[model samples]
Every structure is written in C-alpha cells, then in structure tokens.
Target: MRVKSPESLIAESGADLEGHGLKRTMGLFQLVCFGVGAIVGTGIFVGLSDTVAEAGPAVLVSFVLAGITCVFTAFSFAELGGAIPVSGSSYSFAYATLGERVAFLVGWCLLLEYGVSVSAVAVGWSQYLNELLDSLFGWQLPAALSAGPSDGGVVNLPAVVVLLMAATLLVRGVRESARATTAMAVLKIGILVAFCAIAFTAFQDHNLTPFLANGVGGVTSGASLAFFSYIGFDAITTAGEEVRDPRRNIPIAIMICIGVVTLLYCAVAVAAIGALGADAVGDKPAALSLVVDDVTHSTVGGGIIAFGAVVAIASVVLAVMYGQTRILMSMSRDGLIPRVFERVSPKTSTPVRGTWIVAVVFAVPAAFSSLDAVVNLTTIGTLAIMVAVNVSVVALRRSHPGLKRSFRVPLYPLSPVLGVAFCLYLIWGTGWTTWVQFAVFLAVGVLVYGVYGRKNSRLGATPRTGAAAEAARGA
Candidate 1:
C-alpha cells in the first residue's frame, strides 16, 4: 500500500546519465508522430463502416464528440505527465499518487490494453495485408494459413509475421523506431489526404440529405464506439523518460495529435458520405476503399487505399508495441514484475529483451486464437485506467498541494470528474460480459500481486531498510 514519493520518481527519471536508462532523443515532432502513428490505425481504417451505419452522415459529429470525450482525460494526463515524466506512463503516475497496489492493478490493466491491442491490430492487419497483396499480385494467402483457430485456421501467419517485424524495428533503438514511425505517420497522413481529395471529387449534395438519420441517440452510440479510435494517443506519456524536454513537448504533442486525428477523421467521414450516399456505405468492410472503388470504378483506386491501410496498421503495431515495453519496464523497476522487463541494452539504449518478449507473448495469441472477445478487455481496461488517472489528479492535488505541474487540468474537480464519468459510461456500454471478464482479469491480477508484487515491491522494501539501519545504530 506504500505510495512512492514524487521526488524519488523525478530523481530516478533524471539519473539517466549513461546507458542505464532510455535515451532522451525524441522531440515534440517525434512525440506527435509517435502518438499519431499509434492512434491512426486499423480502427479508423476499417471500422468506420460500422460507425457510419450507426450515425449515417452524422458520423462526423460522432467523431467530434468522441474526440471531445477524450480531451477530458487528456487534460489529466498532460498535468501528471508534465509533473512526473516517467517511462511508466499512468502506471508510474498511479504509483506516486495512488499507492503500490493501485499502481500494480493499473499496470495490469495497461498490460491488457497494450498487449491485446497489439494482437487485435495484428488480426486486422492480416486482413489488410491480404487486400493489398490480392490487389498487387492477383493472389492471397490461404484461409487456413492466414486465419486464427476461431476463424478455422491452423495459425494466422501474417499476423505473427507483422508482430515480429515490429519487434525487430523496436529493438534497434528508439531513435531508429522514431524515424521509421515518423516517416510512416507522414505517409499515412498523406494517404488520408489523397483519399479525401478523391472522395470529394465525386461529392453529391443529395447523398447527405438525412445527416442525423437516427437523431441524437444514434450519434451518441456511434460516439461510444468511435471513442475507441482515439485510444492510442495517451501512449505519448510512455515515452516520458525518452522524450527531450517532456514537460513542454508531451502536452503539446498530445493536444496536437488529438486535434490532427480528429480533423482527419471528420474530413474522411464527410468525404466518404459526400461521395456515396449513406445507404451505400452501410456496414461494408474497408469503407474508404469502397468509396474510392465506387467513384473511380476500378480495382486500382481501392488497391491504393489498401496499401495505405497496410502502412497505417503496421505503424500502429510498431508504435503501440513500443508503449507496452516501456510500461512493463516501469513496473519491473518498481519490483512489481520480473527484472528482465526493465533491463535496457547499453548498446541500443532500448529494452531489447523485453520488447521481443512482449512481441512473442502477444504474437502467439495473434496466431492461434481469435481476439473477437478478448479484445473487449482492452476497452474495459483502458477505461478503468483512465478513471484511476482522473481520480489521481484530484488525489495528487490534495496530497501534494505544492507539486509543480506544468499543465493543470482546467476546471479542476469538474474536469476529471467528467473524465471519470465518461469513462465509466463507456465501460458500462461494453455490457456485462466484458465487465465479468474484466472482473476475472482483476482477480488474477490481485493474486499475482499478493504472491509476488507485495513481497517484492521496492516501495514496500524502503521502510524495512530504513528501520534496520536505525536499529543497527541503536545497538
């Protein structure tokens, strides 16, 4: 139950003089690209069809509301990330303000969010890979080789292949990873712009007649689903120790990433709807490609879109996998997990072993099992962690009134309170099955903490050492 002090956390973050810690090489541009790389992935690329079906042409409004919902929690993240600036992201933030047990549980939740997200993205990546390959080569991988067990296949080979490829890039070094990710981020953004330009060329005013097909209720529900599209932006905080001047850059990157993603999302929604009537876009997979195919009437335009999806999704896996390694590294440093997770390579200045370990752990599931159900855990876990972060802001404000926060959550209690409320509402929207699954996951986390984390926690060990030193002096 011991809470780490902010001073010690900050001290450890700066003691990175040599190869002992993550190298501080990323600036605001890299940070923003890192975030955009993670955020603009398969979700927006392929899942827009369902969202559009729910909200009609008004999916644009859904995207805006979803972005607004994320802003509430983003404010809290900006505040604490600026103040603490640790590699652990919210897990470290929770440790200093919420206590070790809470921190462990939060870390456990992050493991679900990042770990499962990678696998889920991999599964989706396989679909796009098949699309791009079929477009270019007139052939696709066999169903048995490309599908998971649930989908009636031996293993998802392409999924495993992509995950390993991402792992390979990550172990190289954060700078190398950053450059690759930044280039991909820019390329993907250009692709989206190209998509908008093409879709707009065929704009039909009559297709957008009933913008609000089902009124406010449909937009609300669509926003609930679209909210998940913005999940990867908070990943910016995971690079805290690795970012150059994090306090200034982290907040700026987050806000900028969110704004850019939101605008792109809205623009794409409008373009797709303007090109094809809302009814035509109803629940088709890869809706962007569908819009382009309808207008250009050729497999070539759709093929280009598929290629964009390929790069977009791959960038997501690379960036999000990076976040997962850093989160585990933070937990390992606190002695809440195995020390192997924290060991960074002196040569590369990255957690090579841990990065590969994470990739292997998630890659197996991506290959053998379908993530249709398990993926829901990520939504529940992400919401739960965001709730803790929102509450941590209030608790930290009260606990250490004088702490230096470069950016404070504006509107104080109301802002974070709304953040908590929105997150809990989304959690409930996931339904009882997900709640039960998350409950089971939490029980397992508690068992792990009791058996290992509590006994080995560095914070819990501190007082014992202090008391032993005092007793020796007395004797």
Candidate 2:
C-alpha cells in the first residue's frame, strides 16, 4: 500500500526511458506533425456528417465549442507534460500527484480510450477505402467482407488489414513511424484545404438559413460528438520521453496541434454545410466526398477526397496505436500490467510485442463490431481521463509550488477548474447508457488492480526486489 511519491515517479520514469533505450529523435516540427497527424482524422472525415445531423448547419458552432473545451484541457496537458516530461501522459501525472491506485485507473481508462479509438478509426478507414475503390474502379469489396455485423457484413476485413499495417509501421521504430505520419498528415491537410477551397465556390446562403434548426440542445450534443475529434491532441504528450527539449516542445506542440486542427474542423464544417445544406450532410458517412463530387460534378473529385480519407484515417490508426503501446509500456514498467508490455525491442527501440498485442486485441472488434457502439465509449473514457488530468494538475501545483515548469496554464486554478467543468459537462451529454458502461469498465479496472496490480506494483515492493528484478531481466 505504499504510495509512490512525485519525486520517485519522476526518477523512475527517467530510469525507464534510459533503461529501455527509446530514441529521442523527434524535434518540435516532428512532434507537431505527430499531434496533427493524430488529431485530424476520422472525426472530421466521417464524424462531421454525424455532427451536422445533430446540430444542422450549426455544426460550425459545435466545432468551436468543442475546440474551446479541448483548449482548456490541452493547457492542463501542456503544463503537466512540460513539468513531468514522461511517456505515460496523464497516467504518469496522476501517479505523481494522486497515488498508485488512481494512476492505475487513469492508465486503464487510457487503454480503453486509445484502444477503442484506434479500432474506431480503423473502421472509418475501411469505409473510405471502400468508397475509393468504388469511385476509382467501379467496384467495391462485397458487403459481407467489407462491413461489420451491425452493417450486415460478416467481417470488416479492411479494418483489420489497416490495423495490422499500422501495427507493422509502429514496430519499425518511432522515428520511422513519425516520418510516415508526417507525410500522411501533410497530404491529408492539403486535401482538406483543397476541399474547402472548392466547396466554398458552391456555397449558398439558403443552405445556412436554418442554421439553428436543431436548437441549442443540438449544438451541445454536437459539441460532445465533436469532442472526440479533438481527443488525439494529448497523444503527443505520450511522446514526452521521445521528444527533444520536452519541457518546451511538448506545450508548444500541443497548442499548435489544437489550433491547427480546430481551424481545419471549423472550416470543413462550414464548407460542407455551405456547399450542400444540412440535410445532404447529415447521416452520410462520405459527406466530404459527396460535397467534392457535387462541387466538381465529377467522380474524380470524390475519388480524390476518398483517397485522402484513406491516408488520414491510416495516420490516426498509427498515432493512436503508438499512444496505446507507450501507455501500456509505462503501466507495465510500474507493474500495473504484465511486464511483456514494457519490453522495448533492442533492434528497433520500440515495444514490438506490445504493439502486436494491441493490434490483435482491437482488430477483432473493428472487424465484427459497429463503429457507433465503440466510438461513444472512446469519447466517454477520454472525457473522464481529461477530468482526472485536470485534477492532477491542480493538486500538483498546490503541493509543489516550487517545482520548475517550462509551461504554465494561463489562468492557474481557473484553467483547470474550467477544464474539469467542461469535461463534466460533456460527460453529462454522453447519456446514462454510456455512464453505466463507464462504471462497468471502472469496476473491471478496480478488480484487476485489487487482484494483480495492487500487490505487484513496483512502487509498493522493495526497490531491491521489484524494479531490480525487472532491470536484471532488461525489461
């Protein structure tokens, strides 16, 4: 029951990074690209249609609201990431300020968030890939193979394939993965900019006449959905140990990621609505492609947008899978999970085994399950994690006022307070079914901690025995 103190956690994280040989290859630009790569994915590509359905043309306001909420939490992430500069992101921050138990919970929630997120994004990728095939070749895979059970398909083979591809990339090494992600990010952003530019040409005032058709309630609901789009910004914080000059670069990268992605989301939302009206955008999975086709009156335009989506969702899978493996590595280093997860490959400097395991674990669901079922779960888990991180920042600041921080939240207690408040507000919008599911997930986490993690935790064991044993094995 011995709680690991902040100083001990910080020291241990440094030791883990050094002991495992994670390469510090990412500079500020790469880090920003990673953040952007993670943030600007399926949410805008596919979820935009859902947001419009909920909020009508007022989805533009929804994006702004969601972005503001994420901004508040991103500040908390930036401050803590700068101060801690560890790979676990919120999990490490919680262990420092809260305790081993709460840290385990945060790590568990992150597993749910990152894992489900990768799977959901993979499913989205499959949809766009199918669309691309149809548009470019006049053929698509049979529905039985291309869709999940909920969509009347036997399995989503494309989703599983994309997940495996991303897993292969991750095992190659962080530097290699970063390079690929950056290229994909640049390509996708370019396509999105092109989409907005062309879509605006067909913009009509009549399309926006009933902007508030769904009312304020719908806007709030849309914001909650849009919040998922912004979930990946904190994925950058998970790279703290691998980022050069983390204390400065982490915060800078987070802010830059948030700003760029938010603007892009708003612009896209406006362009889609202005071009085709709310009814056309709502409930359409390939709404962006539809807008492109309508604007240019050619299948080629839609095919191009679909191709961009394939690249965009693939990048999301890569970044999110990377985040999941790192979080598991951090947890395993603390003995909260199996030590296998912490094994960094000597040749690649990556968690090869863990990446494969994560890919398999999520791939099954992505193949047979529905996206809507899992996407909301990710949003709920992420919102909960954000609240915990905000609380952790407030506690750490009050307890350790003398700690050096390269980045500070702009408004002190107010910032974190609002961050938590906004998260709670969004949680309220997730509905009671999601709340029940979240409660069930937390209960399972508690059981696992009580059964295994609590007793085996490195922080609770004698240093000479626990960490020493692990180090001797070169884990």
Candidate 3:
C-alpha cells in the first residue's frame, strides 16, 4: 500500500474540491455556527438523562471531564486542519501522516461515527417532536408508527422523515444549510437560557446534596456517555474544503465552538439537576422538557422546551449528514470507495447522490433500531477516530517539520499525548460490550480494505522507491 504524502494530499484535495464543484463559501462565524449546531443537540437534549442516571447530580463533573478531553482533541484537529484543509477531516490527516490503509480504516470508523450519529439524533428528534405535539395539541403519533421495534413500535416514521428532510436541505447547498443551522442554534441556546432561568427559580439545595451518590466510578462512566455530546464539533473539520481561508478559520472556529458549547452544556446540566433533581431527570427521554414543566408548573414551558429540542436535533442531523457525505466524497475521490459517491451536481455544487445514499442508510436503521446501542457504537467509533487524529498530529510534526501550519497545537506532543490518554480512558469506561462491538466493526473494515480499498487506492498506482518510499513507510 502506497502512502499519500502531505503535499500530495493537499494538492489533490484542492483539485478535488474544484473538480467536484464544492463551493468555498463558509466563513469563520458560519463555521463556528456549524460546530455549535452540531455539538449542542441530542447529547444535551436526550443523552443528559442517561448521564444523570450514571452519575446523579455529579453529571456536571462528567460534563467537565468530557469537555476537557474534547478540548485536547480539538486543539489537535485545529492544528492539522489548518495545515491540511480537506473534506475528510481526520481521515485526510491520517492519510497524510499514517498511510492509505490506516486512512481507509479511519474513514470506515467515521462512517460509523457520523452515519450512525445522524440516525441516532434523528430518533431523538422524533421523540421530542412527539412530546411537543402531545403537549400543544393533546395528541401524539401512534406508537406503532412513531417508535422502533425496541421501543415497541413497527417503524420510526418520524425519524425517517427527519433524516430525509435534513438530506434535502444539504442537497440544496451548504450556505443555506449553514444559515438554517445558525438560526436553529440561536433558537436552541435561547431556549436553554430560558430553561436555566426557570429552573433556578425552583432550585432546591437538597437536590444537590448527594451529588456524588454514584461515586467517582460513576462520574467517569457518565463522562464516557457525555463524550457523545462533544462528537459533532469535529464535524466542522470535515467542512474544511467548504470554508473560506481554511487555515485560519478552521482553528478559530473549532476553539470557539468547543468553548461555547462546553459552557452551555455545563450550565444546562447544573440547572436541570438543580431544578428537578437527578433522580427525576434519570431515564427520561426528554429530560429538558420535563425539567421545564416541573420548574414552571406549566405545560407551556414543556412545549417550548420540546420545540427547541425538535429544532436542535434537526440541526444535528443536518451537520452530521453533511459531514458523512463529504467524508465519502473524499474517500471516493481517492478510489477507496466507488466513484459514484464523488460525483457532484453542477447545479447545486453538492454530492446529491451520496447525500441521498447516506440518508437512506441512516434512516433505515433509525427506523428500526434502538438508540442506546447505536449511541454506544457511535461513542466508541468516535473515540478511536480521536485517538488516530491526536497521533496524526504527533506524526506530522516530526515528518513535516517545515510545513506551513497556520495553527500549532499548544504544548506540542504533550497536548496530543493527553488527548490520546483521555480518549483511551473514556474508551475503557465504555465497558466490554462496546469494545466487542468496536472490534467487530474494525474487523469488517479490515475485510473491506483488503478486498477493495487496497486494490483500488489511487496512491498505489504511483511507484515510490528509495528515500521517498522510506518516508512513505515511516508515515
């Protein structure tokens, strides 16, 4: 297997972006909005309940732990993204520093990360939509049509519908999608602020008395789950090809997105626990909406929170679906996947076919599968990807010492080392079942790479011997 050099990858990516008709219209603020939109969705609205169950009121500490780990990884991403602004995000960085084989595996893991995440978020949106409808109109979708088999329903029609809608928005254009995402992000943040205000009114000091009811181990476990909320900010890196002045914009946007979302997540966690208590929040599907109702003593408050959740999850589906298609497009261009996925529509300047393909694949599982299992799979895949990215930074620093990096990771190897260690620590907390599932997924990825990717890789077409070959081998 031939390794694609960093210089080669960057040149090819520039040509691919133009040849594939992807527009470079996203600015720093818009990119930051995309990250915020993706990062602050289902994780806060739905996953918080699961975190609360794991660590009780101490879920706040879980949020902090997850945020710190993500911050370290984010710095690595910013540095690499600035140096090699491409659509594949970590996959591209890995290709430049690791090898085609490693890059292919990274891309496969991302398929699981972004693809399944979109589906999971869509499912969460369906639940919140049902809550909103029932609150405002006094009627809900029939369970047979609204939920998956695991949730005692035949098909999650709402989930499928939301996925299709998000795909449609993406097929239109990135600018339009960014605008929509920004609007939704503002709306959701506003709702969260309102929720905090109301919840504080009902805050009971005793609710936080047994904050560490589940112990330090529980807080660590909760952080493992909370890590899911931090997953989507990296999706912004996937938009490297679409952003203007990517070198400067990518790093700035990543830091801003992480900082803003971490603050919001911590505040929301505190308010929710303070108002309704962790026990009440635990196991509830739409915990934010429940907290709103309990705090304000009105169905109207719940309805508002439910509506915010509907918009929040939609933004997540949009950003994640966009990231998935772009990653596939990058892979397809490198001949790792079928070329059909690389085709871009002249009219829309978007990969319409690949977008729909992802939509169908995402929608089906979401229509019939359970959320917890899929979420667990997504978190593990993401952790693996994060580890690869952090390592890529360390490797690139040594291999390409003179490369013009617009942003450098602070503290050099220390940042990336901590990033890897933190990611592995969270992975350990994910338990045996998640590890088994991740191993199975990677096994399938290896089979695919051996059977198809290695044979078809564009890089392997060129021969590199002597020092260049040695460099490729080192990479």
Candidate 4:
C-alpha cells in the first residue's frame, strides 16, 4: 500500500494547534530562554572538573576550540531552520530534501540526542544533590544510591527523581516549562559569574606554567567534553512551530545564544584554572562546589554554588526533555512513529502521552545506569545528528535552488563544509567505542525503518495523483 507523503502528515499532525484549546503561544524571547536554559547546565557544572583533569591548564584552549566547532555547526542549523521552518529541525529538513527513510533515521538519532541527554543530565543532578547534602547535613547519600555502577554506585534514585520532576513540568505545558527554565537559567548563569569573579581575585600567575602538561591529545579530549556545553543552542531551532516569524527569528536566536553561552564557558574555564591550579581543580571531585570552596576559603560559598548547580541541572532536564517531546511529536505526525506519541492535550497544548513515554525511557538510565555510559551515548548521538544536519543543509541547497531562504549561510558551500569537518573532528575525539556503538545504533534505526517506518510513513504510503505529486515536487 502506498503511504501518504510526510507533507500530508505534517498537514495532519498540527490540526490540534489550530483549534480552541491547543494553541502554542511561544515567541522569540521565550524560545531563546529555552535554548539558554538547556545550554548552561551539566557541561559546566560537572564536566568542567573532568575536562580540567584531562587537559590541565590547557583546558582553557580546549574551550575555545570546542566553541569554534559549535559556532560552525550553529551556522548550518540556522540555514536549515530558515529554509525548512519546521518543528522537527533536521528530521523535517531531511524529509523534505532527502527522503522519508533518511528522515526516519534523523528522528531516531534525535531520540538519542535529546532523550539520553536528559538521562545524562540527571546523572549530573545526582552529583549536585550529594554536594548539597554533604554541605548542609554533614552527610551524603551512599554511593550505591546516589551514583551509577560506573561511578561506584549500583542505582541512582536522585537522578530518577529529577527526570520525573522535569517530566511533570513538561506535561503542564511549554509556557510553564519555559518560565521555569528561564528562572533557573538566570540563576545558573548568575552563580557562574559570581564564582568566576571570586576565583579571579585569588589567581596565582605560577599556576599558568606547565599549561600543556598533558599535551595536545589531552586538550582534544577536554575539548570533546566541553563540546557538550554547546549542543543545546540548536534547541532553539526545534521550536519553529511556536516561534513568531521562524524564518527570521530562528537564525538570529541561535547565533545570539551560541555567542552568549560560549563567552560564559570560557570565563569559567579561565577562572577555575587560575584560582585552584589545574592539578588541584583536576584532583577535586567533579562538583562545582569544590571550585567555590577553593576560591572563598569557606564552606558557605560552596553551599551557594551547589544550590546553583541543582537549579542548573534542573533547567537542563526541563529544556532537553521538552525538545525530546516536541521532536517525537514531529515524528508521530509523520507516521514514522506511532501516532499516539503525537497526541496533544486539549487543555495544555502539549503532547501528554509523548511526555510520559519519554519520561519512562529517560527515567531508567537516570535511575539505574552510569553517568559515563549516558555521556558517551549522548556524545555519540549528538555528534551524529550535528554532522547529519550540516550535510542536510548542503543537500537541501543543491536539491532546491529556487526555494526561498530568508537566512542564508554567509559563505555558501564553504561554511557547511567547515561545519562538517569540525563535527567529524569532535567525533574522532570520542574514541573507538563510541564509534562502534553509534554504528550499531544507526543500523538498528535502519532496521526499524525497513520493518515498519518505510511502509507506514505518510510519505511512502500516500499515493499522490499526477497533479498533487507535481505540486509536492514543486514545493
């Protein structure tokens, strides 16, 4: 049986948004807040210590390197978002420019990028919870209860709680969720700025010596971890349906968010290395609280920093989880996934069913798996999706030369080529295991499409009449 084209599914999927109660009321500022909310967490809170351990003082340069790579990818995303102006980001772009099969693959990869990202963030939340506990009660949760097996714990209850809570907020609605995220994003950024200011006062020039202690390999590894901080800026483009004038606003919002977040990451890198020295910063546990303690010579500052990290991790959980639900909504609408996943609540204008399903999937790893496993999987997934996006931008430009693009990539083909190169370099730094796992995961996605998605896709199933097919081709 011929299936309907994805264009038809896209037409069908958003019917609820046009009715009485299911309206998306988001604008550019709120969308920008969502991007920043997701961008500022985890990578800075927990990954900083690990990056320092990897590169020593040279981690500062690693941040710069990673920032450049992200900026390049952001350009690709901006162009695609403007051209497609769809809710699924790369998934929608692929469907229109590539094919339904390739679109299915992109959607599956996004499930990993956003879903596992939330699980990975929950793991970071567990650490901050322990930090706050240690400071306030002079007691900490047992490692088995607070961490994953890789980190010496058997289960992670705190992580699960964080995921569940964020899911509950998402179920409420996007506006409510964005409001909460915006508040937390501000708090997290404020706390980071405060830490940098205090830490800079205690800087010692001698700590800068032996900056390359671990050599170029270590700096590349550190850059790999720091690269995580920049992934969430593209989250803004995912909200195309809700944005006012998406073609104009999305590119601007992405560039703004990327530039702002990059500066913040660099400042934290410089301050942490200066005050505590690379060795001491690397030696301490992977918690922001330790950085505060080293700078202030008091436990109080550590407590405040821990509080900020908790809020920071919470915002990441909310923003990334929201991204996951919205993308699934897009896929559901396309018929590559079950239609149930796209069901929206009449009162809330949110996909309640998809929200619960994503919550359960994320809750497992957040509750029981190791943070390292989640991070590795997320890094691999994110790298794959970004590379796909860069390639998609070039593919679309070639396939549809006359299509109107409100925001053009400044240097044309060269910009996207550079984007792809940078993404490939970051993937190389992730090591062999990530590569093997990513390949296996991608094969599974292909299998899913072969078995079900290809047949059920609105694109392949819907047979357009001659005039309709021509119209679609023209579009």
Q: Give the number of the best model, judged by lDDT.
A: 3
Q: Residue by residue across 26-101, what tens digits does model 1's lDDT show? A: 9999999999999998778866876787788888888987787689999999999998888888998898778788
Q: RMSD to the native, candidate 2?
A: 3.9
Q: Rank the candidate models, highest lDDT first.
A: 3, 2, 1, 4
lDDT per residue as tens, model 3, 386-453: 99999999988888899999999999879999999999999998999999999999999999999999
Candidate 3 TM-score versus the reference: 0.98
Model 2: weakest 10-residue lDDT segment is: 466-475
RMSD of 4: 2.6
**lDDT of model 1 at residue 64?**
88
Give the alpha carbon lDDT tens digit for every residue of 1-475 in model 2.
2344456656766665436668789999999999989988899999988889989988888899889889999999999999988788999988877777888999999977799888889989999998999999999999999999899999999999999999999999988999999999999999999999999999998999787998999998888899988988999999987999999999999999999999999999999999999999996888999999999999999999999999999999999999999999989988889999998888898989999999999999999987788777889899999999999888888767888899999978899999999889888877889899999999999999999999898766765467544432431
**TM-score against truth, every candidate:** 0.94, 0.96, 0.98, 0.94
- Note the Cα lDDT for every prediction shown: 0.86, 0.89, 0.90, 0.80
Worst 10 residues of 3 by lDDT: 12-21
Name the TM-score of candidate 1. Answer: 0.94
- Worst-scoring 10-residue span by lDDT in model 1: 466-475
